[model samples]
Target: MPTSQIAPFRLLRWFAGLSAIVIVLIAWANAWVVSSFLADHLFQREAAVSRDFVQNVLVSDGSINYLTHPDDPELQRSFYKSIEHLSKMHDVLRTNVYGRDKLMLWSTTQSLVGQRFDDNDELVDALQNELVVHAGRITPEIRPKDEYAGLSPRANYFMEIYIPVTLPGTGEVVGVVELYKAPLALTQAVQEGDREVAVAAVVGALALFLSLFWLVRRADRTMREQHTQLLEAETMAAIGELASSVAHNIRNPLASIRSAAELSLESPEDHGAESARDIIGDVDRISARITELLRLSRTGASAIQPTDMVALLQDCVADHQNTFRRRQQELVLDSQVTQAVCTVDAHLLQQVLHSVLANASEAMPDGKRCQIRVSEASRKTVRIEVSDSGAGITPEVLKDVFRPFFTTKPQGLGLGLPLAKRIVEGFGGQMTIDSQPGVGTTVRIDLPKA
Candidate 1:
């Protein structure tokens, strides 16, 4: 495919890829933030629940007294029964009571009771009256069974909470309550929230990607159209230069051939004098066509000079008056500007006007009326209109009338209007044509005043 066709798709792909990357980054960041928030929220809720359980249910004046003096079998049995009942109510996998010395005073796992945990950070923090919460792999000694036998395999995923138990009516730290929670519901909620956030992020990213893709595709399409137009303009410019060079090369030979034919026609006694005359006529026509092409190719380098508009128009009309008269057509000149002076290349302007006149004459081959009107179109500009009462150009044909080498007539070279348009534009003027089939055609030229 051409670069023009491929460039847009490449740009679209680049935009899509970049958007996808951005979406992934945004989604990851969103998920991280949401997960962190949910985790903190769930931990805080569990900590609050554990703190209440320790203060209201596990640590009371009687419980603290019984813990201080565990020699009373009835009080110890009551404490154990209370801990066991509370453990069932809450979804607690394991429970441990730690004294001020960081030694396990009692545990639902009776085997761990009386164990000294001097280096335990959770016990140390709890003794300082600070609650500690953590979730991690289960240690072999701390693993729960029996009531939590089904949770043993996932014991590694348990959340352990340590809460301080202060003495009643005093701020003194007495003991600590350690609760290990399964965290199945909390984990499930957090995972569900993460999934929802991921889904939303993906959907939002897809929407944004599609919108950006559409916009990029639209811009790419516009660029491709402009590129194609630029290519066409460049091609036309190259063709104009080529035509100019070819016309220059052919004009000399055409002149030589016409001259030789004219010399042969001068021989009245020559048997083929008529053929010689025909040859001369054909050569002259070819020479005229080549001259038009040469005019189309030339870029006027001369500075614009002030010229009398009325006199210029009159002179151009007079030059073509003989041809119109010979063909029995009427040529009318109408000027509305009082001081008709404009800045233009006189030679180029004359060529444009003469070409317009020839086209008008040809349009009205039946010797109908052709008119030229000059008027002040604006304060700084003048307008000239050449109109003819003849078979007008069709809409389809009119669109390409200014295109070089596009002619309706069989013998027409078709460079006339295009060359005229070029000359007018070179002087910063504009040229336009308006026509309707079977009605008439009008050519308008607007130029700046001197």
Candidate 2:
């Protein structure tokens, strides 16, 4: 209910966890859909551009007829005219005629007019059976380093084309016509598209991440504030229940002591002297018990501190050793523990140990073995086990063990174990009990590393 008991750490952690999940989903979605689509589109567009470039290299009908038929010189003239007509429709760059032997018979470009292309299988195949040879960049096998170096002196440069030429007059079999171009242009286009997709994905992911982070963090802050208020309210309610009982138990004695002291002041005689001393002692003892009850006021869970496990349990043991001895009880201590370093409140933790010890001591009527063991469970936690060979708790009693003032003993105003559980839990530790009807009972406290 009060504003002073709020914590934000829990809320922040929740928000961070959720925001991470959302960002990952966004990134995966972009990769699966947006990026893939862009890549496919770029490849298709590049392939189309290469195809268009190949169609613009027609110059003569003779070249066309030579591709369509080997022995069709008559129709070759009409094919040459057709090629010239096709050339006029688009921007013609260069036209070259190659024989079946792959030598350049004629070329519109003066520089390549007499060039021999016999070694180029793409050209030879197109001239022979008019096979359309579409060649892109030469592979490593086709252009080994030494061989490619002697030919073109650079890598990643090539073209693609359907060459159209002729066989002997079976019909007009178009020779292979290569629409050749440098791979650099197409590759660059594809790479640029990829870069754009990458940039978009990064930008989109960052935007989504930031937005989700902010929203989640804001929600977490609000949730944390609400959770804090809830915990404080719970603590106040628990303390209130215990406080009412404590106030009721101590007030009667306090009033009796006050009335007796005032009466003793008036008398100052032998009759009141002994009675006064008895009343004062009783009041002092009751006040001590009330102080212990007041300490049970829950403060929710606090951060754990690094504490010495051995020393912590030993201190409680030493403090209660005399009480046990006075009752003729056997007190044993074992320090063979796995984990030593733990985070806990020194004062509150000691109180928990003392409370368990006192309860164990009271369980035995005459004398019994009260054993305390401190050992390590794992690297991150220390385990403290306090066991007693006394009248163990029954099922009915165990059910109400931590309920305030649910005492089995006639003289008990039971808030001890409940307060201890609260204290341990507040420090991110666990308190548990295992008991039998008659044999014994063990209380285990597991504290985490600092």
Candidate 3:
């Protein structure tokens, strides 16, 4: 395998990179849209104020009637006199009034007074009753050198607004009121709006990225858990198939052997009776091993519910009483808690108890003591302890006790302890075994309290 394949790209880094790209793009787009909107909004407000100034203050006293005969020096003088003082007070660099013929009718700068500006789109649109405001910066290349000369040294930005003057009753366009003013206030307002939009975009982008990261991380964990379960399911399926094959091939022969041995024992002849008895016991042990394999293959967890472990332990002890007596083993039950309730499948819990108890009884062939103790381990859990007074396991054998199909006894299939432990853990419980060589073995099971 290549070195690149040894350490592949992880999901977290991939998602984080993708999230950063997407969030950055979104933030940029939002800033652009909000900035454009704020600039347009401010422009519209300024245009409204300019229109109001032209209609109400400049043309209010019927001086607007002078534009029809715009070439008249007397009318031009009267129009300039009326608006000149007000325009200069408002920081107007230069103003030009254009008639419907696209002729510069009136001007604050004497050089442009008679000039016809037919190429001026702002004046043409305003002549058709449109309110046009063109905003830009003043440069050395600006046209009509007369107006550019009057501009202030500090005022780089300018607002050129065009307002149409109509008759009193009928809404008609006679001439355009064009004003060239410095935009110090508008510049300040736009700068403030840009700062606010930039801050908002950054905060919003961070929030979105964090949310996406959290959701992706949660999904990654869920995927890993599902993958582990799929592997476990495939393993169990393979084991089930093997167990089925072994049982199909070996069970019938073992049964026939056992039956033949029993028949020979029934006969009066004692010649081969002892050997027949031995053969019968061996066949029965093989059959027991086969049955254990079948059970192990079919093992799975059932839903857990509240169960009174005191009654469960008593019932398990009672069920094995006759068997224990035949083996000459002493069974004792001791409990600190009377009604120790735990969350587990009742049938599966009984099976676990049976396996451990049977193992304990089988450990001592010469009638030794075996005890079961129940107690509340904590507010959240209940504990069951099973100890046997038999030849305890050595350290080497003890470590492998819960390993599947690992055993020391001659006929042991070695699935009992492993199966028991699996059943206990299936319902969110724990099982542990402690043993000292030549002393005894004690198994403890802890289950969550209901």
Candidate 4:
């Protein structure tokens, strides 16, 4: 409630003020439009009333006595009565008749019985049967000084219509019927109201624009901060995974070395030489494991190269050909993938295919043939499928198949599927698995086209 305190509530209040300003501006614009329409409607209504008065009342008797003979008392009464009726129908200031000489013979106001209106040529022309209607400044010189009696000093802002009055019997023009109506007051009032509305509308529009701009700015900043936080979190997760693997992988080699050293210590006389040899072997194994970890972590290690996909797949299947034969299993390769060339790292991709194939072969029951299917799924990708006829992985096992360190085999490290996933993703590809418990399992690797 303080005048200077700026809190979150105050900020939100500022936004509301902006919205209010926009609302005011829109309201003002609508007001202006309505005012303009009303003004136009008023003018049209005034004009229509003036026209109807002349057409129905002034010319109703069909006698031009009011114009031809102003002294004819009988005809004069009818004219005065007609003027009275017209005056009743509208807010008419005055109505009068002018002759060829430009003298006001008669008027609704008895005071202007014989005043001369011989000033403007347009009025003169109207007396000569040239019906004229004009709306603008009126001067005393043109419209006899007494004509503006009982009217505003701004009477010049009035709109007057002059219509030729003709005799009923003969089609001869006798004089003119002039009708006066002022609109300055109404127009000015409406115009003043419009100015207020316009001010409100402008203020509202500015406030709304400012509010939207600030809100968007705030949202953009929040989004950017969130994006940065997400990136950091992802980076930390990767580091954590790397750290875990480093500890786990190093433990095995370190354990092997410790065992070799302990054995040598226990039998230092005869088995010491053999123990030393075992130590060297342990060190070599640890070095190899380190190399494998480094390979897995290296960035851009699987950069693509244009190579024959069919040839690479052929090599992978050939390597497993012996394994299949030794296990008394059949390895059938569908060689319909002749035209399949792709951009890929030949060695890394071969490793992925070979791993899937080896898994497929191992998954099958002894003497069961594992069918290997390789072909182009489309022009943009090559689909390599390895399906085994053996009992497939169960739902629980399939769920964690691709997880790091998850394995079903007795002597397996459970790292094969995860590594395969990494290698495939590195090449901008995907590997998917589908299996049924009692049926068979199919591992499909979809690779990008060359």
Clashes per candidate, residues 3 or more apart or on different chains: 0, 29, 0, 3
* Displacement of the residue 258 alpha carbon in candidate 1, Å: 4.2
Model 4 residue pairs with clashes: 21-204, 22-204, 25-201
**Per-residue C-alpha lDDT of model 3 across residues 353-405, encoded as one tens digit per residue:** 99998888888766788999999889998999999988888999987787666
Global Cα lDDT for candidate 2: 0.66
How are the candidates ranked when ordered by lDDT, highest leading? 3, 1, 4, 2
Best by TM-score: 3
Q: What is the C-alpha RMSD of each candidate to the true structure, in Å?
A: 9.5, 15.1, 9.0, 14.0
How far is 157's C-alpha from truth in model 1 (Å)?
Answer: 5.8
Question: What's the TM for model 2?
Answer: 0.44
3 against 4, candidate with superior TM-score: 3
Q: Is candidate 2 or candidate 3 better by TM-score?
A: 3
Least lDDT summed over 10 consecutive residues: which range in candidate 2?
85-94
Better model by lDDT: candidate 2 vs candidate 3: 3
Best by lDDT: 3
- Residue 66's lDDT within candidate 1 is 60
TM-score ranking, high to low: 3, 1, 2, 4
The 10 consecutive residues of candidate 1 with the worst lDDT sum are 148-157
Q: Model 1: per-residue lDDT, tens digit, 150-231?
A: 6635334467889888767887887888888876666666668768878887897778878878888899889986886576
Which is superior by TM-score, 1 or 4? Answer: 1
TM-score of each: 0.55, 0.44, 0.60, 0.42
The Cα local distance difference test for each model comes to 0.79, 0.66, 0.81, 0.70
